[model samples]
Target: MKSSIKDVVGEMVTPFLEENHMELVDVEYVKEGSNWFLRVYVDKEGGIDIEDCGRVSEFLSAQLDERDPIPSAYFLEVSSPGAERPLKKPRDYERAVGKHVLVTVYEPVDGLKEFEGTLTSYDETGLAVAIGQKTYRIPADKVASARLAIVF
Candidate 1:
């Protein structure tokens, strides 16, 4: 692949999102049965609405149409990441401090591969997740995936 279709879309979408004061959460290109899908996740400070999604979808659709990066046809979808939004970047982790989160590590930390609790702190060292009175320091490089956890 030539830098990946997802990367291309990201490059194209970043400027548009930045101009609108929105952030790009993720971009996914996948095949579901006989159909292909290009999904774009975007968000803003106060959250986004359907109108925002529609605008992003339209903007991305036009850019993709002009670029024609993908050889096959694909449905384009733009939407929010919702309450369980992923924590992919440092800024995301920073914003997630004091919130409930679920983090899965590449290696076990304190005999556990996953941790679900309130994120007390996040820094260059990694993250400090408080599971009740206990806190685990997860190394930055050990994080496989992390997302906000919805409280019941």
Candidate 2:
């Protein structure tokens, strides 16, 4: 159900995003307590502001009203992913190169699943992160999750 929602939202939102020079960062549908929330995360070269979110929300609200793809009631939220956003796709990982990042592996690598440091490199094969004086080369397949990290 959530997958279908994400897919539908992704398709319906793309044109609107492109027209506004925004990028779709993520789509999430989750149940919190008694309510269901549908979140759309968007970004651009410059950071997104409240106005951008409001505009996207207004556009998406109209589209959802027109299509009525969702059968159940849900809250729609459109916002920026923020500075410490996730590195979900290959392009995301690629862009994070030379930036600080946090990575979690599926299984322990060097007896640790979590690591944070500078992303020296990321390619089709693997990722190299410099943790202090040591550099660890992590195969991309072993990564459970990766995100830009706040150095502080």
Maximum-TM-score candidate: 1
Clashes of each: 0, 0
Per residue, candidate 2 scores C-alpha lDDT tens digits across 1-152 of 78998999999999999998999999999999999999999998878999999999999999999999998899999998988999988889988899999999999888889999999998988899999999999998899989999977
> Per-residue lDDT for 29-49 in model 1, tens only?
988999998999999999999
lDDT of 2 at 69: 90
Q: Which residue pairs of candidate 1 clash? A: none
Question: Would you estimate the TM-scores of all the predictions?
Answer: 0.96, 0.95
